[model samples]
Target: MAIVKVDNLSVQFAAKGGIKTAVAGASFALEQGETFSLIGASGCGKSTILRVLAGLQRDWKGDVELMGNRITAGKRFQGALRREVQMVFQDPYASLHPNHTIWRTLAEPLKIHGESEIEARVAEALEQVGLPSEAAKRYPHQLSGGQRQRVAIARALLLRPKILLLDEPTSALDMSVQAEILNLLNRLKQLHGMTYLLVSHDADVIAHMSDRAAFMANGVIERSFDRAALVNGEHRMAHA
Candidate 1:
């Protein structure tokens, strides 16, 4: 069954000039345990869609559904909904709190959700993301770029979410680190039987990670690609 559904989704921002539409009637769906990606150039509204799913951008117009629940604007995500969907942001450094230690970063969500054994849970999350437990004691500034990103991934996983909204998850990392993070994400997804909605501008990243992908432009999803099309590199283009 489709775990994510979006129909006639649109988002607008009040720019200096006037009303600027970021996503205009964009729509797509993701099946359970599938990785669906959005590929496009910068400022094409791909990330906007992910923000909507992540509950970061709520002042939007359209229909959004996750795990069979219809989401409307201004609705705060709490309880099971919050636990079931998590987001890993694009910039690891910017996303993480500078002053917060890695342990606190990963432990906060578990604590908020009333999860037990905070210590063990934090250690396991770090290990699952290929980070040493000691790394948790350090702050974001004390760790390398790659390590910070790994912590971010671990934080997103602590909830055992069914859907992960990844917004340019590895864009800020080096090429080698990007590969590692992508592999880690794939492994975790398989291990947890989770679905993914990813937004990235790199065609190779989309082709490598996606079971299917949608090519968006301006503010609308222009077309979609299946595994076969992705393998054939049909989605590679100037805008992609």
Candidate 2:
């Protein structure tokens, strides 16, 4: 069962000096309940592809399907479609509201979707991310980097999304904190049977978290690798 299907996707930006191609003719698919990663150096179109799938960047040419439904460019995602997928951004500090309490942050999504039981869901999400309920009372600034990122994860999980698009989920954290967040993500995915589309530059992170990975460069996916092959130092790079 393929949960996400992208084909011939291309994105360009109108920079001050003419246009810049951020993603060109990229295509990939993600199976349900599996972790798929895109690995490459910075500015290699990995994050751009993630944003496109998340429906944040809609100006692109291609076919994007989630759960078998085609997602047309420029069509606003609403109701069930919007709720089915959620994204966890790269920068914890930037992604979260500095002044809002964690409780408010977690509850906002439920409120937008007109869902009831906000308190219960928020508490459960916090617990699921291994954060104490008291942590919800604190502001983003009051929490550690890992704790803040956990809150971000908790916010995404509150909606019970089927697919999670992660962008460098632990890049800003310390090594120990990175391990903790990665483990938390793994546990949550297993418990919820969720699918993941993670983007990162670190091969070790890709090996630790992904079942399969695509190496992206120069606005295209160059090659795909199984986790075992990547871990064993065996990979073949082919241009897209």
* Alpha-carbon deviation at 202 in model 1, angstroms: 1.2
Query: Per-residue CA lDDT of candidate 1, range 106-188, in tens?
Result: 88888888989999999999999999999988999999899999999999999899999999999898999999999999999
| TM match of model 1 to true structure | 0.97
Error of 1 at 13 (Å): 0.8
The C-alpha stretches of model 2 lying farther than 4 A from their native spots are 235-240
* lDDT (Cα atoms) of all candidates against the true structure: 0.91, 0.88
What is candidate 2's CA lDDT for residue 113? 87
- Model 2 TM-score (2 dp): 0.96
Question: Which candidate comes out best when scored by TM-score?
Answer: 1
Which residue runs does candidate 1 get wrong by more than 4 Å? 238-240
Cα error, candidate 2, residue 76 (Å): 1.2
